[model samples]
Target: MRDLIKDAIADLKKGDGFIYVTADGSKIDLHDAASKGIAVTPVNPKNQVIKKLEAAGLHLNDGKFLNELNELISLVTGNGVTSKTSKRRTFSDAEKSKIVEEWKKVEAAGKKTKAAFAREIGVGYQTFINWLRG
Candidate 1:
């Protein structure tokens, strides 16, 4: 892991972005070393630097470097990186028909489109349109 960090620093110095590989062989772009505050100026890759980078790449491929980096980032930023997830909503056929009927009533009463009625009823315009399509 230390070797990987060192290589990452060297890579950053050379204006090259570090590519982190996971145990599953997925590649993630970690940007440059400067962005991670590991190094600043570009440096020529010497024998020592090359060896360090190769070690780092191995650690990255094994998934150790990424976990450590994530932990470090969470410690510094106060929040760990995470993906967002949302629950899917399901509507019944009867509910869809009722909503379409209500939309028609709103349209009869001077509402320009079903979008306004959808907003009043708390459904998204696209969702309402999809319901209408059925």
Candidate 2:
């Protein structure tokens, strides 16, 4: 019954002409002279067809109904997630100063003919001198 009324409404709109429907045992023409659409007023207020059409029209006009329909669509047709991990580390300023001080000692020793100190620290002599200046 609902689908029939839905189709009838669509057809009436497409045809854009008078559609005769029995309203409470009386024949009446809906949208008698409309150019773009049809409008039918059923006489029996409690008729099932009239109730269904009214309900459908009300649901179509409601903002909350549209929001709920959108939510249902998103639930049924959503995409999956992807990874979002970072790959970097942070160090404190104190830690950096300690490392620089250790390098400066080896560099100062390497300059005073203890070239083996720089080699033992696994740093080039020039690199050690650069570290000592900081």
Candidate 3:
């Protein structure tokens, strides 16, 4: 929701970012909560985020930005994943060729650039170019 984005940005502008809004319409003062509690574990925001989205008229099945909303929430709350995976993603030669073929087909249709196509397929632009080169 645009409201959510604006709210998140406004919270950023507020500086310290102690306030967090949850799906239940509850506002949390993070520092206060942590101070009062013995310990705190980050709550998974998936369900709550979706609930908020639904309340704002966006749904999981029909025309929604679930991943983007989650990302924005993570950034606003400073709860984004900070660790990288030990293993890197790899695709086989056949997969690379298949992706390149699809890219070519899209290009032939004059629809999008390698970067746009890469984003559409959720891969890095450089990786898509490497696939195209082969």
Provide the clashing-pair count of each candidate structure: 2, 0, 0
lDDT of each: 0.58, 0.49, 0.63
State the lDDT of candidate 1 residue by residue for 1-134, as single tens digits: 66566655665575443345434544334454436544333233443445665654533322345556566787788885543332356778898898788677667888466665665555678988888887
RMSD of each: 20.6, 32.2, 16.0
Q: What is the lDDT of residue 46 in candidate 1?
A: 47
**Model 2: per-residue Cα lDDT at residue 119:** 48
TM-score of each: 0.32, 0.28, 0.38
Residue ranges of candidate 3 with Cα displaced over 4 Å: 1-87
- The runs of at least 3 residues in candidate 2 whose Cα sits more than 4 Å from the true structure, single-residue gaps closed, are 1-12, 25-58, 79-134
- The whole-model C-alpha lDDT of candidate 2 against the native structure comes to 0.49
Candidate that scores best on lDDT: 3
For candidate 3, the lDDT comes to 0.63
lDDT score at residue 63, model 2, on the 0-100 scale: 39
Q: List the residue pairs that clash in candidate 1.
A: 4-56, 13-42
Positional deviation of residue 121's Cα in model 3 after best superposition, in angstroms? 1.2
